[model samples]
Target: MGGVGHWVVIFAIGGAQAVLLALALWRRPVNRAANRVLAAWLGLVGLDLGVKAAFLAAPAPGLFRVLLFVGVFPFLYGSFFYLYVRTLTTARRLAWLDGVHLSGFAVAFAVGLPALLAAPDTNLANMQAWLAGAFPPPVPWYSPFLYAWSLSYVAAAVWRVLRFRREVRERRSDADRVSLHWVMAMAMGQVLIWGIAVVHDYVRPAGIGYFTIYGAVAVWACVLGYLGLMQATVAGDDTAEPGAPREVPPDPPAAPPAQDEDARLPEVQARLAGLMEDEAMYLAPALTIAQVARRSGYPEYLVSAAINRGFGCTFWDYINRQRIAAACRCLADASDTRTILDIAYACGFTSKSTFNSAFKRETGHTPSAWRARQAAA
Candidate 1:
């Protein structure tokens, strides 16, 4: 009964992943490379899970042990994830050097071929021994190579996600623009699972570690599926083309003759205020300091400094204050009947959670409570 229950869980997770992969692959206009890479990653995960389920249900010798080659997929899947992040963040075509990341899997397969081709009796004995906590001697170079290769790629993926976050924050006021928070969470989840698995291998050496690792993989699949479906585009999809020259902001006008730092500060502050107030550029949702700088004909650093010195707050705080102020007007207007979410979005918020928190921080009342008080008055 215990074995049956385990098989059931495995198959269920595998089946769900398969369905998600198919939907992602077949879903719409076939233009997005990120979607394709994501689908491929899901496909490999599903394959890994399916192989595990089959091997556990009926632990055969020759075919099942050969199927164990699929175990190397953690390395492959990690590469796929790295590529997916690259695609989303840069939209660059895969480079030839990217193939080098998979060299570990190739080496492992080459080293394991002899064991896979051994007689059925021999393979069966090996499998039983492994299940009994008797791991075979590590392949001369392949074991350490796979470990280092896989760990490096996972670390790279985490770094890529962190870089993506910083880039987005620099360019846009909306932090959730590409749902990068979810991507970062997924990458960190992989790191944690991999780290724990490594420790378990050294300390426990118990076969139960396989179940724990695969179980985490299954959960990771579900999370990726949910986030992938929620995302309309992985990133802005307006990434600069590979090797294309970036558009430089036209240089700010020369400083007026003899204009000291103190004298020039107000001019910068006024221009920033004009952009935020008269144009309502703050409602752009992704407004960034660099953007404000470009539009105001000021250097990025000067723009940031002006906001900090003149407004007495960070760029994010100043922008959110404007958004909250706009939200307050909409909330107070008795003629406006739009839902809070609609108002939130119209006022440049990307998500309701952000809207609520900012509104509360700035106004000291939730939108609903503030709206109620206004109505009563």
Candidate 2:
């Protein structure tokens, strides 16, 4: 590591922040299960940072041994993140079977335990020799496995996030709020950090300090802590109602709805249009397909199909288009005199950021820019 003292200070501060964030997540009321998983991950990160800091500060044989032990713990981060994503997206409790993911960590830890029992002088000598650029016997045998496990699990988490986003769009108007985009960013950030660590480990090029790797980790810790706390508990497609029984897997494939049933889609489409245009259903910020179906006296699936086929868009796009149109009219009305945020709320957007994104996507201009253009024109 290049600035050993500075790196030590950085690691100490990061470790403290991570542990504090972990405690906060543990105490947070909402999203208890997912938060707890995140809390555990942060706690492990704190412990890892502390070990690295200690090793950097002293480089003692005992500290070096402990560092080796903690080194294998990185294997657990991927599993923790994957579990966190699963819990949030599925709203389900983790079962005992999930312990299988820890096997890699356990195996590595068991294999490296013998290093601690070796003679202290011999371990110190080896540590010194290795730091001095001499190859040694215990040559990071776990690197390949560690990289594969972590990357694969992170990929799986990203997959779940994508699926969750699609499902949310189909069900709720406030899909942007719970889309889990942050999870995708965080996972990719982890990949980047891992990439840096890999280059540091293998290349060991001059001027590219070890501290740079951990510094990226420290920054990532801050981002992860903030985003994980702010993310809401995403309800999945299979989420059941208060008194509803859990759905079981249907047996095998079934035929699609007949053409006769499809022929009535035009009527359903008209009803949906009337609901949006006349009833202003899109103005309900928390509107859902089930609510739309109830209002239209149609089944939810049929309502969804009508929106998909008749509107040539997903339910989310259809609803957001209506919202954007309403917002545009409001923006053009000089006499309305509502703040953009106020207009966003009135037009069914839950947040200014979400409103801004949808508005720009539909109009090719931000709300403010659009209003300015209309005023100038």
Candidate 3:
């Protein structure tokens, strides 16, 4: 039948992509890896659109579009899968491999060498036959290779999430389940999009072309990402309601309106920083919002307000930053006389697992590795 259905899906999908990329850029302090990966993925999206344009207008449409859609785009999918997980979980961890990532850039240079060359435009039937015979869905070799590269990253991210979930559940540690949910949300989105694409490849019907298949798949992705972002915004609020009255000293005029975000933010940041430097609220065995606020001569309500508005990190991440910050000192100091558990507890973390996870979040390296690096230096 036809390609390029309606104006709405185009605007809708494009809007969703822009919103996600914007939110990721605005909210995350550690999103460089995700940013790089998203940039590459977006570039692929552009390439997909370009090939579809060529399919409509080119005299050799069958050849050029087939080569691009089958061989080139499939390889790009491999890179996209790797980057999406890397974007969500370990942007910092992969920073060292920047040089290796750059080496792949010199791949185009290899085409000039005798043994290497770029792909030529091929017939649609021949390309389809090539994909069907050699590189099928879950291609055993192709699809799974991208997945294998993500395996360790997935495991590490899952461990942090589950570990954080356990801590929030037990009330023994400060990390929350929100971050866990965020990671899981991203994983589910990836699986759903990729899963449909794989299924469509085999169960192909006559009129459902490559552009339509990818367009359909991307529609689902945009929907899921939109829903996830909406939930993240709601869940990020520390207070139950935006304009609800805060815990006051039983006085009406003395307390300001609950949602005075701009007026309170600087005060919150400074007070929270003071609590961190002075009381070392981070190092307490069971630090509570009540305790920190009281120590700072403020209400617990005000403290939560400060945390949510000023830092944008949850109370969990906020306190963990302090504990993790302390852990860095012990890590750097080289305590021959102390154990990791001791350092962990001393830094206000209740358990080794919590300490290890939080340390990784703050520094991207494990505490032992950090210490070793210092020692090596």
Q: Which candidate is the best by TM-score?
A: 2
Best by lDDT: 2
Estimate TM-scores for all models.
0.76, 0.88, 0.41
All candidates in order of lDDT, best leading: 2, 1, 3
TM-score of 2: 0.88
User: Each prediction's Cα RMSD?
Assistant: 4.9, 3.8, 18.0
TM-score of 1: 0.76
> Which residue window of length 10 is worst by lDDT in model 2?
235-244
- Model 3 agreement with the true structure over 1-377: per-residue lDDT tens digits: 23344423553455456456445543433344454454455445544544444444432534443434333343344344344444444323345654453332233233222212223433444344433444233223544443444343444555655654543432223443234456576555555555555555656666544555566545544543443334321112222333566554444224568667557767877988987898787777656676676688776667777776667766777888888888788878855558777888888877677788889988999988988898787
Q: lDDT tens digits, residues 1-377, model 2? A: 23579888889888888999999988876677777888999999888898888888878887887877777778898989999999988877778999998987887777777765678787887678645646243446767777888989999999999998898898889898888888988898999988887886789787555578777787788789888888765754433333567666445334357685588789999998899899999999878888898899877777877888777788888899999999999999888898999999999999888888889999999999999998888
User: What's model 3's lDDT at 187?
Assistant: 54
lDDT values for all models: 0.74, 0.83, 0.54
Cα lDDT of model 1 by residue, 271-360, tens digit: 988998999988988787878887999777677667777778767778888899999999999999999999999989988898998899
Off by over 4 Å in 1: 1-5, 12-16, 19-31, 119-121, 130-137, 140-148, 203-208, 238-265, 286-317, 329-343, 361-377
